[model samples]
Target: MAYNFKNGRESVGDEPRSGRPVEARTDNNVQRVRTFEHQDRRITVRMLAYELNLKRETVRKILTDNLSMKKLYAKMVPSS
Candidate 1:
């Protein structure tokens, strides 16, 4: 960040990269994860990942960050 500022970059935000942007945490995925959770709260992160063709970490993020959910007693439940 300091280097970028010294190089005359105007903002602190990240610069655009060359490759395609990540789309794992999209709204569609979030909704799909939520629907799957509602259909079967006992679904595990690995199972969700396999079923949705997403990464385990991505599924976990959808559950914990997007859906505000956590694992409890081997089941997914709302954090609050």
Candidate 2:
């Protein structure tokens, strides 16, 4: 905070950041998830996320939205 004041920063809000936004939902990732699911139908979302180095929410989204799957009896099952 002191450094910012010395540097003549006017506002206290966060500065504009530069870099590409994180995009976990890509065709390649989706394909990889699908392949892993095929190999093991009982894999957990946390395991999948850790294995893929992606967020758990991202893995869940891929399972539900992209793959149309849902949890049943603590296992991933295809939604009707």
- TM-score for each model: 0.71, 0.73
In candidate 1, position 13 carries an lDDT of 77
TM-score of 2: 0.73
Candidate 1 at 40: error in angstroms? Answer: 1.0
Which candidate comes out best when scored by TM-score?
2
**Across residues 1-80, which tens digit of lDDT does each residue of candidate 1 receive?**
57977888898777788985687799998999888878986788999999999999999988888888878877778987
lDDT of each: 0.87, 0.90
Question: Model 2, 1-57: lDDT tens per residue?
Answer: 789889988898877788965778998989999999999988999999999988999
The true-versus-predicted C-alpha distance at residue 75 of model 2, in Å, is 1.3
Distance from true position, residue 35, model 1, in Å?
0.9
Q: Residue 12 of candidate 2: its Cα lDDT?
A: 84
Q: Which residue pairs in candidate 1 collide?
A: none
Which parts of model 1 have CA positions greater than 4 angstroms off? 1-19
Pull out the clashing pairs in model 2: none
